[model samples]
Each structure stands twice: as structure tokens, then as C-alpha cells.
Target: MASGLAFPSIFLLESHLTEDELESLKRQIRSLTTDPGKTDVFLGKLSNRERAQFELRRLGVVTVEKRQSRTRASARADTDSAPNLEESPAKRRKTGARAPSPIVISGSSEDDEPVQIVPPPKETDTIKVVKLAWFTESVARGEVLPLSDYTVYEGRRLLAEPAIMPSPAHVSRAEGILKRAQADAAGSQQPQGGKPHFMQARRKKFDGMPPPRPSLTRMTTSEKERVENLPPIPEFLHTTYSCQRPTPVHGPNDKFVEALKTIRLARQLMGDKIGIRAYSTTIATIAAYPYELSTPSEVSRLPGCGPKTAELFREFQNNGGHVREADDDEADAKLSVLRLFYNIWGVAETTARSFYNRGWRDLDDVIDYGWKELTRVQQIGVKYYDELQELLTRAQVEAIADRVLEHANSIHDGFQMVIAGGYRRGKALSGDVDIIISHSDESVTHLLIRRLVLSLEKAGLVTHTLTLSTANSERGQEAVSWKGNAPNHGLDSTASGGVGFDTLDKALVVWQEPMEPADQEGDKAGETQPNTNPHRRVDIIVTPWKTVGCAVLGWSGGTTFQRDLRRYCKNERALRFDSSGARSRVDGSPVDLEGYYGNDPATDMLTAERRVFEALELEFRPPNERCTG
Candidate 1:
């Protein structure tokens, strides 16, 4: 009987474990579930009676033992008939048996040994299927659902997976939907045919809309007061980003923009680069405004306008639509220096200041003493200073463009050219003509700048080459790639303004219209040479046919407009925009615009430009409307 009796054994239950312990126990249970033989060694280590109890525990059987003293043990010989506590709780309840109490085991070795118990099967509650109407109602009420309520499932099981939150694209879509709905609601609220008198009165009161201004001569006292007290236009009419605004070639606020731009230019002339940038944003904003401003309140509503600008606008209004100018000896001297510095193409405010500090006063002083110190490009700039200062008429630029195109096509039959810069933006006159050249045959684009300039120079159409650098030449391989008017010897060779201004294969030349046969005959007949045709500045940029659109777009800039476009591409599309091409910033891969709008670059350049906008997920703005500055 003693041999058959089982020694006391401790049993561990799932309810007794902590969260971390339960996790570890579950892992162990999964291991056993896959291979039941894994528990053999653990069971073999126990004593015979303990092993029997562990086996019973493994089989979901429980045992309880009651101890009696040695003297009382002989009196009770029916220990085998003792009630079993190893029975399931259901069975015990049915037989009117009390549940077993928890026992504390005591022993140094017993503390390390715990009996493993399988957890009972969990009961799953049926999930309520969510209806689509609930989502619609929540969205209608502008209520966002709790994050936890959103769940992802795999087949029938509720997966313990993370939820994908809404992205910017999703939020934009939602906002668009809401705006359309609001517009619809407003449309429905309007009365059919004619509005009721009360509805019209309500609209007049709540709209905060401005009434048309009457002529000063015809205005009644009450009407004048009403016009003066009207609220400024809504903020939505103005946008923080200049690229989103439409600035026509000729704007209603031209005078205000010009005045602000003059101040900005003065700041630049005084070497105030920070001030120049500050004024640039505001000037661009004012230039894009569609209406001519009449009050300080109107200027105050613009995005970049500040107190100073508002005050300036009010002063302009008081002075009958003109900015007040100051006349002084000191201002005249500075203006002279500003005009002189501006004539040098490669020189900026810092370089101009450097020249000023060196005690150089005028163009003659630069020509006499500072001639040797000037950069090769600056030397050419000073040589043709007066000629370059003269703005070219649209007809002059077009004729030059046509001549260049004729020369280019003469060299290669399929060559293409686009007149960019201010001319492309429909300006009546431009400071200079910028032309972008390309060819469907990519191999022709490799050294096209040198080839075309050489052809033009031979034809006597090009007066002088200020700069003719291939892509490799600009990148500092002048020894092998440079082919232009200036010698490779003693070149500055460093990048201008830190990074190179542009990366396209390009040439800047002094061009004069070829002497017409009549003019040439007149020259031979000594008719004073017809004013010498005044050598005008021309820039020729060469690019591959695939990226000619990018070159044209980059070159046809209203300075601030180009800056904002590049910023938008970088921040919104993860792209790097340049004259050469647009590329993904992520992997440095060239982004092709052809697939975006199904346009062939080999045919139409404007279509290609439109495709670039589409590929970047940007709205296509016409060139004339891009005069942001």
C-alpha cells in the first residue's frame, strides 16, 4: 500500500501565472503541441510516485491527499476510497463536491519544479459586421472614428495587425469630397429663378461682399461711406505659395509690384541679400493680385504683405497711384553705382561691393585700373556694357531666334529651338534673348553648343562669345571640353555663385543682326552703317531631346517663380528639378514625363512641358501666367 501511494505534488494553473509568464508558458505549450515526445526527459526525472501524479496531471486528472498520524493510520485502512480533487470543476459541481483549495509547496528543490497545465479553450464572441451607412454618417458629421475601432482581418480570424493611418493623399481626397458636398448644399439653398426679398436681404447682410465703387464725382455721401467701410476680400483669394498664384504677363498691380521691386533692387545694390529675399516674396505676392488695390486693408490681406508694405500701399493711394521717390546727393551716387554694377553680367551684390571697397567708382575706372582684376567673363561684360544694357524689342528677339534656328537647322536638319526667358512669358521687351536648342538624335546634343556657336560665329551673326561651355567644361574639364571665344588659359575655372547657375551645355554671346544686303550696300555707300545694329546679348542652351522641356521651362523663369517651382518639386514630389532634367531624389533615377500625358517629346516641346507638370502632380500653368515676380 505504501509503494502504491503517491507523494504530494504541486500543480500549477494558468490563472496563477502573470502576463509575461503566461507568454512563456504559451510558447512552451506550442512546442509540446508540435512534438509530444519533447516532455519525456522532464517526466523521467521525477520519483515513481511523483511521476504517476505528473502523468495524471498531464491527463487532466487531479489528486488530493489527507495525512494521518502513525497511531491513527492503522485504524483507517480505506484511504483508497478518499474523494478525488483531480476531477474537472464541472464534474465536482454535479457531485456536490467542494473545489480544491490552493496548496503552498515548501522545499528548496520544489520551488524550481512547477507542474505544467494546459489552458482551457477560449470562447470567441461573434463580431458585429459594421455597416457602410455608419461610416457615411460619421463623415457627414465630420466625426473621425477611434483608431482602435479600425481593424484588419485575415479570412475569418481577427488579426493582431497594425492599422494603416491616413496619408496626405487620403486627407486631400477627403477634403475635396467635403468641399464638393458643401458647394452642392450651397447651390441647393438658393431660390429658383428669382430670390425672395428676405433671402436677398440675408445674402446682402451675411456675405460681407463689397459693392462696386461709384465715380468720385457721382458718389453720394452715404454711398461713399459704405464703400469706405466695406470689408477686405477673403483670404482664399491669396495663396502663401507663389507657384499656385496666377500672375499674368501684365497685372493690375504692376505699379505696386514695380515700386516694391525697386526697393528690393536697391537693397540688392546695397549688398543687403537678406532684405532682397524678404522683399522678393512680398513683391511676388503683390504682382499676382488680380485687382488694383485702393486701400491699406486690401494690401494687408495679401499673404506676404506686412505693416511697412501696407503703409507704402496707403501712401501710393494718397499720392494718386504712384510711389513717392526721394531725391538726394547720396541717393544719386548710390543709384549711379547700382546702374554700373548691374551692367556686369557675372557680378552680383557681393562682387560689386568688393569692387566698391577697392575704390573703383565708374565704368571708366574699371576699364583703366581694375581691368586686369576682372574675371574673363566680366571683361567681356564691361566691353559690351552699353550694348547689353539696351533692352530688345519682341520683333528683334524673334528675328534673332529665327536666324539662330536657320543656322542650327543648316548644321543639322532636325534641330529644334525654343525662345525662352521673358520673351517666352509674352513680354513685349526683354533684357536678353534666351534660346534652348535640342535635337531628336541625342548624339547631336553632346557637343551641340560648341558646334552651333562655331557655325553662328562663322556666319558673322555672333559678334563675340562671352561664354561657350559644354556640360563637361562647366564641370571643370575645360582642357578637354571647352571650345569658345576665350582661351582655356587663365580662366577662373571655379563654379559661379557656389554651385553652377545652370548645368546645360550653353553659350552666352554678343549677337548683332547680320548686315542686310541693302544695309551692306549703304555701308559701302557710306550711310553711317545704320547705327551698327547694337550688339544684343543672347544665351543658347543645349540639351538632349528627352529633357529639352525641362531646359526650356527652367530658362523661361520669372526668377521667384522658378525658385518656388523647384521648392514645390522637392518638398511635394521628392524630386530634384534643374535645367538638365527632373530626377527622383530617392534613387537618383531620371523621371520620364512621356508616359504621364502620352506625349512624344520628339515632336512638341510645349506638350512635353505639360507632361512634366502632370508627372510631378502639379497643375499646368501657361508661360504668360508665370510672371510671379
Candidate 2:
């Protein structure tokens, strides 16, 4: 019976409703089920009202009431009394009755319900009859509104107020005003009396007739003012010390920094120490800057940026962030010398230039003509020149660290190894791998580096030992006395301070990966086998458990960061900083920091480092944030 209720129309109406509208309809329907009179006050459009009637009928809560108009009654009398042909299957179900068999209207039995009569078409009935049904249902539901108030567009059933069109007179006046505005704009662009303005006249006279081409350099007054009045450089950009600023692991001013670095390198090559220092300071400052700079003026106000530096920046800006190589013959020659000297492991700018003055041009030249003059370390450096120059990838570093750990554990259990240096600081490539080994028991690390290297060498991992020093060796005593005797010597002293806290037991070695079966086969077949996998430089430093934190912190660095850390310790805390441990300057007593590091073996190194900072009243910095440019 519910099928005759035109329930399909409700689905069609739902298809057009938005989610929010559907939810609202659902709420209204639920309310109507409780209180049928609620549907009577729903003031929605005819479509909504009819939709509600269809839903109510489907729920078996409402039945349609037929009306006997004159046209409908006449049509009904003419039709044979079967269910009306115009009645849909859905309408038949609404009455809770089966369709009747053919019978005369006057012969219909009282047991059969009367079906709705179909209305005949009228000449004045321009509106669709289905729409009239919706209107009638809306009225029954008490959605009372004037017929003239309803407006629809296209085929959509919308409820909107009728639009009012503007009068023709008002439109004409608007058009007149638009034409006047266009005329005024055209007049303003032309000179008075079609004669040139004073500035134009002067430009024409002095320039001997202006060029026919349009000028691209011209700017309006506002644009000119904006160019002259840029925002001031931020206070943070005024920093002169790298340690005071927080430089991210990566930055936006890479192009600028690269250019400055190249110039600094060139200066170093040219043996201009002062120039190198100046450029380093400026490069560090720029690298630490947070924003990308577009104009030279943006950096003109920064410290360490002199007139020459400013001009270089402007030139770089003009060249689209690229720096061209110097074309001067003298500069190029000096650069060549600088490159040659800088590549030698033990050679500094001073030594490189001295060799250059002695007529050495290339590594071959140095070997052939001055090999005898080279130090033993420099000789080894030349022998493995190509191998030492190659950078170590993070993966290779980790593999080496694993091998080191394997060797350390063989000698004693519970030994901890940390891969420090640039690798620890998150650099993708490093010059060498630095490994620090320690154990909770101090006795385990007494001769750790020496025993570890012997084991690694026996296993064919360590190819050559470049240096080996034990903690109790006489060399350590000599190193200590060297520093103690020279109180006024700068931190750059290579004999003592430059050896990097010589008290710690350490070794430097050349390492190579073990040859696999495939590599051995290739070597036997003489198939131009790989060049022994290029010997890599590795440093192994063994420290007692108590000082492992200081060792890790000291060795993990960007060079400038280490320098500043030592400077801070010396100036601010009156302490001497070193990889082994920190000691008081007054009486050379160890500054106990054991309390900060709890007894946990896994986290003791980190905890101890943090405690060192706390003990010294300094803020702790993470490895990445300690870039210091």
C-alpha cells in the first residue's frame, strides 16, 4: 500500500539536496513522526512540502484526500470504473486497496475505496498540474504564502525574491559618467598645448633628441621612494661573532657563502693569512644569516662587510648570484701555488709558498725535486695522495665504526665506541672517521688503543699505523710540560696545544676494506682491478669511562665550534679544555662532573657532556645547531 505514495519523488528530491539540507530534512521528518502538526508549520517551498507529503505517506501516516471539482467529476463520470488509467502503481498502494476491475462509476460497490479522479485540461491552465498538487499540499501543511511571491528560474524549484531591473534613464547617466572618465584619463597623459614638459625639454636639449626607443629604466615617484627607503637590517644580522648566532645545519645563503668561501680559499692559497682571516669572519657571518639576500644594500650594514666585500656582493648580485674567476695572471699563478701547497698533508700556506718559491709546480715536481726536504708524514701523505683526498661517505664511516667496535669488544666486553668528528655532526661526507673507545671499568681502557690496533691489523682491516700514543707514555708528560711552560703561548701552538689534548691514548691509521672473493678473482685475472679501494684515514682515541663525555664533545665539531668552546671555557670558566677532560687552571685539579652522568652505560656519555655545560654555567647546544657557520 505504501508503494502508491509517490515515494520515488522523495528520492529524486533527496538527490538535489545538500548534506546540510538533508540533515535538516531528516530532523524535521523525525519531529513530524512525533507531532504530525509540526509539518503544518514548515514554510519551505512547494517542492519541499510535496516531498514531505510523499515521505509521510510512505511511512503510512497520511492518506491522500480527493477533491471533486466540476472538470474532475465530469471526467470521472465518463470513465469506466476500473482504477483510473492515469493513477501510478505508487498511487494505487497509498489507499491500502487492490486495483479495481472494470465497472461503471454508478455501479461501484461500497467495499471498494474511491480512486482519485483525473482533472481534464482547461484552456486557462498554463501551470503544470503536478506543480498545482505541490502547491495544494503546501497549503494543507500550513506553508501559506501568496502565489505571486514564488519565483523560479530555468527548471529549478528555487525560493527567491523577484529581481527589479534598473530604469533606462539611470543606465544612460552611468554610461555618460564612464565616457567622461575615459576622456579625462586621455587628457592627463598629454602635455599642455602639446608641448614638452620642462624636464623632457631639458633631456631633449642635453641628450640631443631623445632616442626613439622606450626607456626601461624609468620609474614613478613612489617606486623611486621605495628603492631609496628599504627596511633596516635586523638586529640579529649585526652579530660579529659566529658563536653568538644560531646557524642551522643548512641555510638559504649558500650561493653567497660559496662565493665567499672560494675567495677565502684563494686568499689562503695566495699566502695572505690576514686576508683569509677577514674573509673567514665575513663568510661565517653571512652563512649564519637566516634570509636570502637580493640586494647588496641588504648586507652593506652588516659587520665584517667592508667596502671591497660590499662591492663583491653587488657584483655577485649583478651576475645572477655567480662569482667569476679572477682573470689576472698574478692572481692565477698564486692560486696555482696555493693549490699545490694546500694539498700536501703537513704543508701550510707558509710552507706551500716557500716550496713554490723553490720552483715546485706540481706534486710530481715536489716529489722529484724536493722529496728529501719533505717530512716523514708529508712523504706518507704524498704516497697516498689520491687515496687521502677522497671523501668518506656516511655508510663507509659506519662500516668502519662497526669494524672498530668488533675489534674493541674482542679485547674486553662492555666497551663503548662512538663515531665522532664530522660524521657525528651530520655531514654527509667527511675527510676521515674518528672513533672514541671507552669502558665502564677504567682498567679495561688502560692500553686499549694499542691492543685494538694490533687486533685490527691482524684481521687485515688496518693497513698502516700512522701514529700511536698511550695515556701513560712519556710523550704525554712532555706534551703537558710543553703547555705548562709556555703560559703566554696562543692556542695555535702545534708542539703542545695544537696536538689536541695529547694526554688521551690515541692512534691514527690507514684503513681498507677486506677484499671479497669476486675482487680476488678480478685481481688474479689482471682485469684492471680496483685501486685497493683507496686507503682511508682513521683515528682511534681510547679514553677511560669517566672522561668519555669530554672526549665525544671535544672531537665532534665544526672547527670554529671547537675553537669557540675552548675559548669560552678558558675565558669564562678559568678552565683548560681538552679532549681528555677539563682541569682547573689554578692548581691543575680535575673538575669532577660525575654526578651529572647517572650510572646508565648507554646514556652516560651524553649526560656527562650536558653536565659539563651545567657545571660551567653554560647553555648546552645540540650538535647540528652548533654549526657556528
Candidate 3:
């Protein structure tokens, strides 16, 4: 129904329904599967090529063909003869290969052109999922682990202190200090009898301050008895959205991390006494929260800010820009190694430290010094550091997702897959692909990862395999509870259990590595082999349809969104989740996937996710809107 449904060429005969509309259609169809008629009507709206998406969404499948008729009427007419609910399975079957799949295209041409690529096999191996963990002892030890160390991204709330309005007391103190300073100047410049003037107490005023009263925060006798006992902090909550910690920012330059480190260290030394503060956690969010500004009120009426603080905030906003100083921090940290370390897809803090101990200070140095320490993804990150960081094109991501989805289908029935992460957020380009897959057959599921990897590798489409961990994954945060420096988490940090996951359907893991320029490959020993783009990290997750929604929601998040969702679910909902299962209060421990959510074939990913949202008591977020900052 939308424009731009043109037929490209003979090879790309599929209608060009601009990828966004198509992916959206996929997400939508997956959401509404209860009605066969609705499914038909939805599919019936699209042209033949567009219908491919609907097919894929319904069955984890799709097929492609050469250019076909452009006339809308012809497509409309054909829609009448399409698959119907009443058709028998065998009769309904279409010629699998009589028609080529539209999804088989990879960017590389078949000796075709610079940008044009032949449709490779519908399978690929360069995608994978790695289960992650960090120890409690490791966190407490200040092990400098990856951001994966902390369990809770719990931010202290700036509560509107209705009862304990402590601000006036502080203001009174400041006013007293001002009065004392005036008196001290008026009386004597020198300390009186050598007693410091700053030691003097401030005068109190009876002005607008509220009446002194008993603390309302303390519960009344009746209220205490009536209030239900709330759960504790740091407990694991059952999450429909299983939290998956993300890989840290990496770069090719060893010096890059060093620079960041050195600068941070210098700030601690200088700014600590001088109050130097870390600005943006990542280079990405710097503009939103700067290092230093006088004050720009986040809201018109901040809790602590009286008229004066409000004025100051407004003045700061009006004057020099940011709340935090962006560029002024000393770039004292060495950056070469940081840059190099940045490229390693899953490089944790400990790993980064290992790189540092080895004395690799720069990208060139890492190449020159510690090549062995680098993972395939890191090497790729360095090689194409510039390119990988560049946002992915909408078209490019969609094409790749198609291949991965098809591979999931090949694994077996009850097997499901979906693309999550940034691309799911509707971004044209993405950092890397995030995929989830799952199925009911345990044995067949066992074979899913290996077969997928082998198939994809044999196709010559996947260049390298970086890491792999099968699902039923126990690789969640290792510590009982992350108490010290660790990554942020919501679902895992309930007062109940840890993270909820029984056995994942199966997780197949692979990573993309950077490909050297054609001419440059001659320099490396193993570089000449095709498909091995060293250092680009990719992940594939497999989950049963029962937990597919959890996987999708978990993986479909921006960093903070995941944290917030978990916070609300675990803290507010009183459910406990661990990496392997969910805990219920009426019962004893975590519930198995089948038991946690009832059995239903239609309880697949897109549908199941709706269930999770319903449990969370929130609106359903389509893939595009899911990427909340």
C-alpha cells in the first residue's frame, strides 16, 4: 500500500517495500496470530514480494523469486489464490526451490560489482551468543571487570521530600556562614583569640519553614500492622524480560582506553581535591548530561531547589552551555591501548587490565605487541574501527537479519528467532546484529547451534567464528549479588531470586571479524581465507517460544531501557528471576519455563512478548519504539 514498491532487477525481483515498512509488518504480524482471518487480511494487503515478510513472520520462513509483475491489480488478484486456513499441509506446500528466496542476498557480489552482491545460501555462521558472568568476589575485589560486574543500575531517587524537607536546614547553614563572614569582617580580620570564625553556628529564622513535628516517615502502630512486608533489595526477580548485559565499548587503539583511563585517574587526583567529575558514561550520551554547568533545572520545580537554586539553574542554562564541562577535563590518560581494547567485542575490565599489564598501549602497539591477546572481533574492530562504528544502513541490517532468521528455521519446528538490539529500535544502521532463537525439541535443539554454524560456514558467507555458548545458559552474572563495581541490572536484582531462565532453546554463537582490504590480506598468515572478518562481534540467542518473548524483550532493549524495565518488574512486581528460572512466592523456588508461563503453541516470541508486557502492566512496544535511552 505504501510507495517505492518498485521491481529492482531480474535478480532482485522482489518488490522494494523499503525495509522499514517490511520489518514493521513482520513485527505486527507476529503480534496478531490468534486470528487466521486477520493474518490473511494483513498478508492480502501486500504485493507478492511484500507477502514474503508475512510468511516469514508467521512461520520463521521466507522465499525469494526473480522480478514479477508490478501491477497492483495482479498482486491483488494473486492474493486470492494464496495460502488459506483451510488448505491441507501437503496441498498448501509451494515449490520450495521453484522460487528462490528473496532473503538470500548478501552484500558481496558474485564477482558482480563493488556494491552488488549475489544472494548467498539462506544460512550463515558469523552470528553467535555468548553467555556472560561476573563473580561477587570479583566485584567486591574491585576487579575492574567489564560493566558486567554491577547487578543493579539503581540510581538514587531525587524524591520530593515532603516530610523531611532537609533543604531549608542547609540553606540556613549557608546563610549563617554568610552572616558570620560579614560579622568577622566587620569585627576583626584576624581570628578572635585565634578561634576560627568558620566554627561559629548559624542563626535560625522562623520564616517559611514548616512547623517542627514528629517524623511522618516513621510508621504509625496501625499502619505498620496493616502494611504488607515488602521484599528486600538485591534479590533476583522473575523477569519476562531476561536481562542480558551488553558488551562494553571497544576500539582498535590500545591508547584509546589508556587515554580514557589516564584522564579518569588524573581527574580523580585533580578533580577529587578539585572535584573533577566523570561526564558522559560513554562518548554517545555526553550532550545529554555534560560535566559542569551552573544549573539548568531538569524540571521547573526541582524538590530541593528554592527560588534561588532555580534562578541559578536558569542562569547556568542561559550562560555557557552544558551542565557538565565537556572538553575541559585533562586528557592526561594514555589512550592508545584503550583504542585497541575498544575493538575486542567482549573484552571485560579484567581483560583490558591484562592488555595493560602486557604493555600494549596503542592499536599499533597491540598489533605490534599483543596480537595474541586480541579476539577475532577485536582485530576486526581495529581493522574497520571506523566502518563498524558507523551506523548500519537500514537496508543492510534487514538483509542480514533475513539470513539469520532463515537459519533459525532450518534448526527445526518450535524453533523461533528474531532480531533485537539497535536495529530493532528502527535505526537504519546498528553496531552489530542481536538475534534470539529457540525451540521445544531438546535433542534437535542440541544440534541447532552446531548445524547452523557449520551450514553458515560451509556457505562461505560467514568469515569467522568468535565465540559460542549454547542456551539453557547459566552464564548470567556469577556473583550471588553484585555488591561492588558491577554492571547494572533490573531483572537479576530482585529481592527474590537472580535472573529467570530455565533452559534456553539453544544458543548458537558467532562473531564478525574485520576483513582486511583485499590487498592487505596478503600480509597476515590466515587473513587470505574468505568470510573471516576478524573482530566484529555478533550474537545469536535461542529460547523456547515460551521464553521467546523474554529473550526478545531482553535483547530488544537499549541499555537503560532494560535496566528500567527490570527495575519495575522485580521491584514493583515482587517476582524473582534468575538466569535459569523464575521464583514464585506461593511455591518454593524459580518456576520452569513451561510452568512459569502456560503451554500454548501460539505463545511464540511476538505473542509471548505481549504477555510479558501485560504482566509488566505496560504498553506493547514495537521493535522500533523499543530502543529507549
Estimate the TM-score of every prediction. Answer: 0.58, 0.57, 0.45
- Model 3: ten consecutive residues of lowest lDDT: 124-133
lDDT by residue (101-193, candidate 1, tens digit) is 333222123212222222221222212112223332434555534322331110111112212233344444455446645765677563334
CA-lDDT, candidates in order: 0.60, 0.59, 0.42
Q: Which regions of candidate 1 are displaced past 4 Å?
A: 1-238, 324-330, 472-499, 521-531, 596-602
* Model 3, runs deviating above 4 Å: 1-295, 298-324, 329-340, 353-359, 374-387, 411-415, 440-444, 471-536, 578-581, 585-588, 592-597, 601-603, 618-628
Least lDDT summed over 10 consecutive residues: which range in candidate 1?
151-160
Candidate 2 residue pairs in backbone clash: 1-93, 3-90, 4-90, 4-91
lDDT of 3 by residue, 217-318 (tens): 233455345333322211111222323112122222222223333444444333232212221122112111212222223211222223433343343345
Q: Pick the TM-score winner.
A: 1
Which one wins on lDDT?
Answer: 1
Per-prediction tally of clashes: 1, 4, 104
Consecutive 10-residue window with the lowest summed lDDT within model 2: 120-129
